[model samples]
Target: MSRHSEIKKTVLRGVYEDNAGIPRSTHGKRQSKFAADSQEPVHSSRYPGKAVLVAVLGLVALLGFNLRLVTVDVAGPAAMQVVEEQPLPSYRVQLPVPVSPVGALIPGNDQLVSPEPIQSLDDATITSGRYDTMLTRLGMPMADLFNLQVQTIVIDPGHGGIDPGATGHLGLKEKDVVLDIAKRLRDKLAVTGKYRVLLTREGDRKVFLKERVAFAKENRADLFISTHVNSLPPGAGSLNYVETYYFGPHTDQRSLELAEKENRDSDYAMGDFREVIARIGDTLKTEESKQLANSIHKHLYNNMKRRNRGLIDAGAKTGPFMVLLGVEVPSVLIEVSCISNKAEEARLSTPEYRDRIADYLKTGIVDYLEERAHRRTIEGGIIQNVAKQER
Candidate 1:
């Protein structure tokens, strides 16, 4: 054997001698060679773990800082927005200072005046008599604080010429009857000299609903009264009565039907008037119109009752009457009598009955005007007192 083989055998002999193994000669030589041929062992250093932990912490810190900046940037403008959306304050006026009392004696006068004639502040009197004269000139009620005095009245005779309203069994036309009544009313009111009465139509002629309302506005009327006659349909049982109406929502089905009937004319249908009526439906003089209707209705019912024993009082109703729209004044429609009924028709045909209606209607107008004047007197006094205090 060579020297190298001899060295290896020597190492094996030592290993076998120590362990007393039988195969140590070949196995020990192979094991020593395999161990010598292997690579060097690697060692883990503490710096690598520390470096990983530091890098993770740095990344976490950077993310946390960026999140804080995002939160502030998003929330800052929203916070400012709330502060910017506030309303401005309203304006206030400065009031005038009160004045002191004047000297008891007249200025530039040397003569000694009686102290008894000089009234103290506590003895100052507030007389309403002065306001009454001013209120009367304005055509306002003298006794009421807020009342309108009637100066100009417009009497509208419903349906004329081409439009012959409702017809009676006795050949009496509604247009003719109402026109005569209107003329009589105009004449009666003219005699008073207190009111400026004007008729919408002088003779039997076709007058549109719009024209009637326009006339009242053009004349600057304080009150508008439209006269008409009520009639029942052929199927409806005879309903003979006197009723008054003001422009408003219909009170009942009957009032609506009556409004529909009265609104119909040869020149225009219900459709045309509806749009016009709706346009001017919001009336500022609703309360005044109601008062006028009630006043006229009461007098009509009371006066007609004396003449006709079985006169039915239908009371005041509210209906959308085209003639009453856009009047710019207190307006009412008076259904004098039921021309469809034989007995009522006979009465309406007579001159005496028409004259009676005209008289009662005039009385109602005068009463309303006087009451309004009385109300104005009270209002004027209050306003005068306020003016004096302000001064």
Candidate 2:
């Protein structure tokens, strides 16, 4: 080849070519046209290695791109492309920490909650990334914690407004009696100013079971107290007793009946509600509630039995009442006195008797709190000893 042709060949070889030997030009740039000759660039398909090299180079360039964006077209018959890839935002999923208007959860290792605990079925958070929660590494509440203090309480007066609950014994309305007892209990707790107390209803007004639960959950109640009067079949022999309940599967037919009655007007679908309740039943919430029930029932029966000799100790029982559902803390429903029993109804009607019930409730609460504090002390000591050992 002549010197000029050699120069031309060298320049043509430097030009970027695709698999088809098509030279791609930069904008506003023109290639030097040469006479048609045998030295013209051959199709890369003729040299399979050249075509492979071109594809490899395209992939390499795509990877080295600053944006790291790419679109591969392996089977589309289209060339590989660079695309602006957007990634989804990453977030940290955190479980809710309890807070209340009356008292925020104080920073402590003790993670105590109420006896009537309810967990939200819809509290799921979708997130990506490493979140550092030791207790809830598996999206479960810390069952080992003992609350350091009982600060906020929600008192629920069952049956209000048009729903008069059980109305059979001596014309004494459950709505009125429970409300009265709740108010008196609220007053008793408030007088000490040691606890932040709130009532679900102040007067005879309609409040749905869900509403009561929402109120407690919203307020981040440490303890939830639901006051209700129990009723037996009208002819069922004078069953006068004081019973307390925590969230659990009903233990008896009577308990199931009570749960059905209390669950009236609750909007939750039975299937979904039972599923959620069953899930919660196996967790710390249920266990804590049982503890609270035992405490309150002990106090009520121990103190009240002496005052009223005929008072039956129905004992602390388990029932799946709607009012107790979704409390998200230690909570209990107290059947202070059976409304079906004319004798118990007569006692519940008096102001003095209601005041006494409030006092008993307060004692139960205070006792539970003291027990909680003592537990915190013991747990704290254990943790400290473990740390020291590690050191």
- The numbered model that scores best in lDDT is 2
Worst 10 residues of 2 by lDDT: 71-80
For each candidate in turn, the TM-score is 0.59, 0.63
Candidate 1 stretches greater than 4 Å from native: 1-149, 235-237, 266-284
Query: Each prediction's Cα lDDT score?
Result: 0.62, 0.64
Clashing pairs in 2: 112-147, 114-329, 114-330, 115-289, 115-330, 115-331, 116-330, 116-331, 118-328, 161-205
Give a tens-digit lDDT track for model 2, residues 59-82.
644554221211111111111121
Cα error of candidate 2 at position 339, Å: 1.2
Clashes of each: 13, 10
State candidate 1's TM-score: 0.59
Which lDDT value does model 2 have at 228? 87
Per-residue C-alpha lDDT of model 1 across residues 287-366, encoded as one tens digit per residue? 45765676688678877877776778887767877677657677899998888888888888899988888888887776
